[model samples]
Target: MDFKYVTQEERERLYNEVWDEPLKIVAQRYNMSDNGLRKHCKRLWIPLPSVGYWAKIKAGKKVFKPDLPKVRGELKRYVHSYAIKYRSDIDKYSDVELQSMKGLSLLTDGTIRYVNEICSNIEVKNQLRNPHNLIKQHKDELMYRKRRDKELQQASFNTDYYNITKSKYRENKPMIPIYVSEVNLNRAYRIINALLFAIEEMEGFANVMLDSGNDKGYFVIMKTTFYFIMMEEGKNKSKNNAEEHVPILVLSLSAGDEYYKCTNYSFKFKDKVDEPLEKQIGIIILEMLQTANKILIEEMLRDREYEREIKKKERQRRLEQMRKGELEEIKILQQAASDWNKAEEIRKFTNQMELKIGEIEDEEKRHKLSRWVLWAKDKADWIDPLIEKEDKLLGESEYIFEEIIETQ
Candidate 1:
């Protein structure tokens, strides 16, 4: 009923794991309860994590991990159970469960350290040369918007241009989501195309989501869906009589909702004084990808917990159904009545066979037919609970009514 790790190597591994994350986490990985794992560690002379160890690490503070003490004296001689079984435990499946638990030891600090590890071989170019398909589509849409705006601006006495412009912005083929001025529209597309290519280079897919009539940037990276948005941040400038915001690209990432522990992160980019946005595009994509990995890990944990709950509920439901099926008396009577009806149908069919057997002229065939009719009548009697007839192949008459057996 229990699994023990008296060996020094096993104890060391578990000790390192507990110190690496926390007792609660290593317990989950080993399919052991928190208290149970703690007790085993104590028995094996393994060191446990100190209080506030994980918290201090999360807060970016220095933390200490004490080395595990030697497992000597009584520990070397005696080995307690590695895992204790509860009342409903089935050890036959322990190997399968442990196999399922394999590779579950997730890195505790990985989520927070995601951005730091994302600085890999990714590049973002400044100029847009042979852009992505989406980039080309948006570029055409941008051109259309610009030309339409110009036509509407120059139409002083034309009411038709005003009417055409009213619905033209909304009905553009593959509507562009960027809200930058004419001066920066092309620049935005180049930056976006560069990021998309950079993401693709790093084994990720980047695309834009058309929500209703607006554009919402999203990408498929690490098998997780992340929503990103790009906006122009700048001071207003007067071009002719109309005022426009100067072009400065700002990018942010978000995914899921509040229920998913929704991740909302912004890249550390503000102005052109440091460098062009294109140069830093690779890091920005990495940051977004890191957050996606975080969300993926969180969702996996939630799903595992949810599956456990579902299994527990399903077991309880089966137990309740079993008890209910045993206690229900009317179902038994209904089953008996149903069997009686079937017996009568069989008898009726046998009667028809007996009457039809006279039409057969062949002697051997007629004899075989008559014997089958008699066997069919015997089967009908066997099926009738009141008659209590024993059948050869189906064994003896065990019950007057077996509703559950019939249903099963």
Candidate 2:
């Protein structure tokens, strides 16, 4: 049968008809090669059911294969059913109550603990008061000092600092606490809690191995630090009615041989907070942090693998150069032996000719022989040139041969 003459449709029809038959039978009946038949079946999208599917089909039971549309409809129905059944429960839930949910509780508690610990720590407290709080409290004073310094074009480096301190003392600043409404605080907490739970869920699939024992996991610590900053802001704002609350988080992570540093996570609320709002801000921050960490880790791994490949290639190239040098050395030694052999052969030939000339007698014959002897002598001179040429070849060979020899 001329398989090439067959159209695609004909091939597909032939494939389907013999698809259920034994391979040998199909090949014979269709007048087609077994491989051709198989290829045709694959192209046609014919359901050549797996053994498991066939067994189930034979048993007269419907298989539980979920189609995309059916699965999507089922999901929609499930979500709708839940909405109908628990609409009131969901709507009535306070932010605090939502944050207390099993999944959210773990994250909220972790963040709260981290914040409290940081605030209570003497060193951290000092840093906060001297740097962070100072920056916030004396923002206007610092700005004024900066402007004055610029205007004066002063050479003194400490002029700006002196002006800021002077301005701060002149103001007689009252300690004003941060203010946050109860509603916003609850919201912020809920948002953060939700974010933490989402991150934990993702972590299950992320293949991140947390440090064992007392060793702090970089990501965990980073999250803790970020949460601490948010919590501190929340607490400070809770006391004063004048300042509006805002959710903000910052995190840093450092690791590896090169001490690669990264902003592990950060988030801030763009909207003004009329009340304490933590939940949404917290959740957004947590999600961003996890995403950044994943990207950083993947990038680091890819770079490390590329570096390893480069080192491997360098090692292979060195080995190849070493092998090449050894081969060239062997060739040079062989060439030298061959040249010496040729020189010895020429020397023996010259000696034999000399011996033959000595045995010849007769005046005319001797005279003619002398002329031949002079010609032979001229030829004998050629040996020196040949030997010189051989020496030159050896010298050139040695000059070209290079092998890396390690010095002690």
Best by TM-score: 1
Q: What is the C-alpha RMSD of each candidate to the true structure, in Å?
A: 19.5, 23.5
Model 2: per-residue Cα lDDT over 1-408, one tens digit each? 344343333444454554345555677686778677666444433334344664676799876442112112223222211111111243354544443443223233444454334223312121122232222433444355456655445434578766664554343232111123444443333333343333333231111211332112222322232222223232234235648553433222332223344334444443334522332434443344444434434444556667889999999999998888777766665665565555466557656766776787766776776677565444433333233222332332222123122210
Please give the lDDT score at residue 116 for candidate 1.
39
Sliding window of 10 residues with minimal summed lDDT for model 2 = 78-87
Model 1 per-residue lDDT tens digits across residues 1-408: 234535344666777788777778888887979999988877777777677878888899987777776433456444421211112232243433523532212223342243234445445555768888887877777678778778777774678867766656556564435667767777787777776765554345666656886777677755666666655656534354356555566655666647565554444454464566767775676566555555655566666778889999999999999888766656677777888889899999999988899999999999999999998888888888767667779876535745446756
Residue 363 CA displacement from its true place in model 2, Å: 25
Candidate 1 segments exceeding 4 Å error: 1-121, 153-170, 182-187, 235-247, 258-268, 272-276, 329-408
For model 1, state the Cα shift of residue 395 in Å: 20
lDDT agreement with native, every candidate: 0.64, 0.41
